[model samples]
Target: MLWRATDRRSANPLRTGLRWLLSLAFGYAGYRHLATPAPFLAITPPWVPEPALVVAATGIAEICGAIGLLVPATRTIAGGALALYALCVWPANFYHAFAHVTVGSTTLGWGYHAPRLAAQPLIVWWALWASGAVDWPFRTKARDG
Candidate 1:
């Protein structure tokens, strides 16, 4: 809590590598959900209209963000987009946790989905920071005494 330099470096290579791996995996999963009617349907709340279209858009966003992270010029945008994408699907994750969204007769518990979903923003931020998309905001400032 006293130094701003704690976050002075860009993401380490191993961590950055992991970020890309996670991004690729997540993007693929999103694409799968978009491709299959059953998975897409499972997440759509009754209140939502045009569930298929929404799923497709989400899938596209995931793909774009995953690709964006690979390009330095687009890394920041990708991170931001990924974060936004995570927020967009939050309701679906919540619904699943509460059993409001059922994938077949199986519903995923919060324990399974929440940590990764909830950690997404931090992940995005870490990726962007690691990719050197921007300066770390307050490593020293926060620790200033």
Candidate 2:
């Protein structure tokens, strides 16, 4: 087994796999946010004071959080930070959904955007759970012997 059977410190394979997948996703998304930012800028709410700066900062945070998630020592902190980051970005998702933001030939309509909005909390929870930053109802049982 990849994870230790008796060692509580070693996360189960499911969580580990989820962690890696989320890290990769965040890393790639971050790169996209920086490398080609026009789409992101288009989705930025007009109410935001400095859209470009926020985009850049969020990209940087995503990349850093991705790296942190892979390191055991930093995993929990990274998870918490990522959870907060996801929450912070929720408004942008809402803006995109409501504004019907367009990028190239594709306009993000309600059908495409509503599910993403609904999934935001799951993303945050995934980060927290995968990194073992917060596990309540899912806590494992200790050996009684």
Candidate 3:
């Protein structure tokens, strides 16, 4: 069956809101990644091959996924892709935190790093929920069992 924002029994305001918000966030981040990749490059793990190419590819992926999230036909796949994308980039986040990556003479403290690391899972969840891929903590039991 084709998935849509209203695929559930009723419309979910929270899901709609998160979908738009995440789309905007990813779209902007994608633009920034393409426009200036220096910061991203700084945090990239040494093991990654062709950091520049990967950064550019990620930018394209982000932009495409962000656009896909809004289209009913592609929303589910987009959400899944984005969730995986977020997971894939986590190593860079860890590198940034532990390596004390400096971008433009500014090294983010643990205060910033900690919350960002913590938010990764939430981001993954948001994409899934917003795209109607899975609903948890909000799904009502049938007849209260």
Find the candidate with the highest TM-score and give its number.
Answer: 3
What C-alpha lDDT, on a 0 to 100 scale, does residue 11 get in candidate 3? 52
Could you tell me every candidate's TM-score relative to the true structure? 0.71, 0.88, 0.92
Off by over 4 Å in 1: 1-11, 113-145
The local distance difference test score of each candidate is: 0.66, 0.84, 0.88
**Local lDDT at 90 for model 2:** 93
lDDT at 76 for candidate 1?
A: 61
What 10-residue stretch in candidate 2 is worst by lDDT?
Answer: 1-10
Candidate 3 — what's its lDDT?
Answer: 0.88
Cα lDDT tens digits, model 3, 66-130, are 99998877888899999999999999999999999998899999999999999999999988888
Best model number under lDDT: 3
User: In candidate 2, how many clashes are counted?
Assistant: 0
Residues 1-145 of candidate 1 have per-residue lDDT tens digits of 2122323332456646756785786679677866776877786766677888887777787778778777655666676677667777777766666665667777677677778567766765665554445445734655444
- Winner of 1 and 2 under lDDT: 2
Q: Give candidate 2 regions above 4 Å deviation.
A: 1-10, 140-145
Per-residue lDDT tens digits for candidate 2, residues 2-89, read: 2233224336787888999999999999999999988889888899888899888899999999999998778878988999999999
